[model samples]
Target: MDKKQFVDEVRSIAEGYFERGEFFCSEAVVKTINDVLDKPFDENVTKLASGFPVGIGKSGCVCGAISGGVMALGMVYGREHGQAMQEKMFPMSADLHDHIKGIYKSTCCRVMTRNFEFASPERKAHCIKITGEVAAYIAEKLYDEKVINK
Candidate 1:
C-alpha cells in the first residue's frame, strides 16, 4: 500500500485493538503493524521485544506502543542491505525513537499512562491510546522516509 493508505491502516488497527483491549500482546501489536504494511512482523522487531513486553521488565518500561514503533522502523531499515546503505538506515532508529518519545512524552508505560503499577484499568486505556497514536505516527514516518529515499 502507499504511504497514506499505510498510515490509515495503522490508525485503523490501533483503534480496533484499543477498543478490544488487546494492545499488550506483542503478536497483537505485530498484527497491527503488519496489516498496514507490505509484510508481517519481521524477526528484528519481535526479537527486540522478546521479553521486553514494554521494556526492561514488562513493567511497561518502554511503552509497548513505542516498542511497536521501533519495530516498524526496524522492518524498513533493517532489511538486508549493503554496508553503506545499512549505515544510513541505522541512524533512522534514533530518529524513530525520538518521534515516538515526542508523541507520547516517554517511551515508558509508566510515564505515558502515569501508571507505574500498570494494573489499573485507567492505565490500560491510556496505554492503548498511546500505542495507537505511536503506531499511526510511525507508519506515517516510514511511508514518508521510504518514498523520499527511494
Candidate 2:
C-alpha cells in the first residue's frame, strides 16, 4: 500500500479505538502502529507507553502522540548496543519530533491543546484527530524507512 492508503487505514483504527474509549492518545497510537505491523512488541511491554498520555500524567510536558511515536520508532530500530541502530533510532525519533513540532508549533500537550475551549467537545475532537494522525504519521515513517512493508 502507499503511504496515503496506509495512513488512512491506520488513522481509522486509531480514531475508532479512541472514540470507543478503548485507549487514550498514547496507547491508541502505539496500539494502532503495532497492530498494523502485526504485533512486533510484546503486549506486556505495550503498557509502557500508557504513562505518556495526558502529557506524562497530565503535566503536559510533551505531547502523548509524540511520545508514542518515538516509542514506536524504538520498537522497530532500537538495539542494546550499536552505532548503526543508534543512527536509525536517534534520527527517526528526531524526525518524528520535528513533524509534530511543525504541525502543532510545539510538542507540549498543553501547547498543542491550546487555542481550544477547555473541557469542550471540540477539544476532545481535536485530541482524537491528533491520536489518529500521529499513529498514521508513525506508520508512514516506518514504511518510508523500509523497516516494514506496506
Estimated TM-score for each candidate: 0.69, 0.90
Clashes of each: 1, 0
| Candidate 1 residue-pair clash tally | 1
Instruction: After the best TM-score superposition of candidate 1, give how far the Cα of residue 62 lies from its true spot, in angstroms.
Output: 1.9
What lDDT does each candidate get? Answer: 0.60, 0.82
Identify the leading candidate in terms of lDDT: 2
Quote the positional error of residue 35 for candidate 2 in Å. Answer: 1.3
TM-score of 2: 0.90
Candidate 1 residue 53 Cα shift, in angstroms, is: 2.4
Candidate 2 lDDT over 9-112, as tens digits, reads: 98899888877888888888888887877887777556988899879988988988778878877777777664466677888888888887888788898888
Q: Tell me the tens digit of each residue's lDDT in model 1 across 46-144.
A: 445445455545674776665666666655566564544556455666775677678667766666666445677666666666666767776677667
- Residue 97, candidate 1: alpha-carbon lDDT: 68
